[model samples]
Target: MTVLVSAAIDEDVEFERVWLDDASWVDVARGWLVGPDAVHSALLDRARWRQNKLWRYDHWVEEPRMGAPARHGFGEPLHPVIPKLHRALEHRFGVALSGPGVALYRDGNDGVAFHRDRDLRWLDDTLIAIVSLGQRRPWHLRPGANRFAHDLQNKGATHDISPASGDLLVMGGRCQVGWEHSVPHVRHPIGPRISLQWRWTSRRGHPVRGPSYRAPRNFSR
Candidate 1:
């Protein structure tokens, strides 16, 4: 099957870099996707979304949001714009970014807690790029000492960035290792939001883990 790219991206989009401690940084580009509304609606109608239940606190609980894995094994076609966006990122960043994982925030209550991307966190250096569609939501980042802290909300100061529809946010350097990020739950009513994420690892030969809330081996307090 031949995949076609979309013309929804702003070819001249410029990124504003935000540097953090320990060689971590984030790049932000507002209004990057020229057709965010159309893309979001298409995914809502075409993508295979599921409510994942995870093992949290010794019990299985439904995850706050709905997700469609990178490989939707049920013959589902990925958004055509996904490949176009990935290629754009790889060209600009000069790295092989892979897997445009999809996540849907149905409402204000749907969110993810502060946690590192398990596969990328332990690596020496990495990059995780995300594009936001639909409604706007705050993405919080803060330095963390714990490998898997269930609750780190009030521990220290946080840098918050609310990426509106069509915005782009890329976390790079040691951001995964030295910092944690989350889209906290909100109270007021809101429409659905979609996040398209892609990641790259400098040390592909090194072992990496999948998404988990539990602490990994060699984790220190």
Candidate 2:
């Protein structure tokens, strides 16, 4: 697996466009940031992490990891790295990437199941940027819904992106509507992973569904 990821990195580390289907696609940039490990360490030490949960069938279920949308909602000024990353993304993609959704996968047991960015589906086209940090993990995508999984070989509709630290993956076009993606749960031992997601919104902004939190800096009355 490492070899495969390495080969992709060697072949292209900047703006390599990959077509997942006729409508959805992704842009992969390996090692886009310098010293991603250090950035991960800093985030672990400073970012205000929060537990997440989902409302399903009139009941609540805990998410597999701790996360927060710190880069949105005017909650607080983001870490210095956030601004730097925003600038880089704007320059590379020429789009205003906003509304961060950061997730910390503590280990193999912690991961998100297959799903789409349904919240951003209001538009015809959208972009979602993900900056991977710490520990490489297989990120998979499959067309339509609920068909992305390990037993995806026979389905012939699944593909994966194993991103190393500092790597960037951008899902664009009708990806949210036409494809489902996942970071399947692992049983074996593995290191932690932090996914920095900067998703799209209107030029102004919009409301999102999900449990909210008050950051460490919250001072509202």
Candidate 3:
């Protein structure tokens, strides 16, 4: 449940800021993990991943990725790299973080579609940090569509982020609510990629905002 970062952390870690529209921001940090190859291999063995279907267009569709969640709290043992990664981010961001799960993309067909993280809508402010491993794919983000700003979904305008092994990518501020991020399907061959989402769990006790939401028309590229 609680993540700890030891003082003898690696010194090679460095962060780069990428600013986006309407004050949104993304932080990319590289060289945080001492041995990324070992970590990635460990995940492949230790993380018991599963795949599910998502309800879209009133039909059940494959979720496009396999995930192995570590439950809500830190009651059980996690893969070796998770806690260390969280602690590193905690030291840098100065806040406690919780990772609900990691999404594993096996290949080009495995990926997430366009959708804002609903958890962010529950909080006024929070952060979602992702630590990447294995493969490099385009993680895209763009402004959420509204009745008047439907043109904002233009594919040419999406922010394309490619995080390699041992890299940390953080999305904070109002980014989750104001913008949508996704890992698009690649057209060519590529190795597997693992993305660990370290997020602040939304207040579970907050009242529901309203009825469930539907993705905007043309939300897909």
- Root-mean-square deviation per candidate: 4.8, 8.7, 6.2
List, residue by residue over 1-221, the lDDT tens digit for candidate 2. Answer: 01111111222445779997786789988887767777677666656789876665456677789986554336543355666677777777678877567789999889766667765635347789998989898787777754634365624346789889989999987777677778877778999899888877442333344433221222246
Give candidate 3 misplaced runs (Cα > 4 Å). Answer: 1-9, 71-78, 145-156, 201-221
lDDT of 1 by residue, 1-221 (tens): 32333437898888899998858999999999887887787778767799887655456788899998654346554666677888899999999988788999999999987777875635558899999999997888878764345466543437888999999999998787778888988899999999999999887435555545643223335
Name the best candidate (by TM-score): 1
Candidate 1: clashing residue pairs, number: 0
Off by over 4 Å in 1: 1-7, 70-77, 145-157, 204-211, 214-221
Instruction: Estimate candidate 2's alpha-carbon lDDT, on a 0 to 1 scale.
Output: 0.71
- On lDDT, the candidate that comes out on top is 1
Q: Write the per-residue lDDT of candidate 3 for residues 39-120, one digit (tens) a residue.
A: 6766666677887765675476677889886533365544555676677788888878876467789999887766666744
lDDT of 2 at 73: 31
Candidate 2 backbone collisions, by pair: none
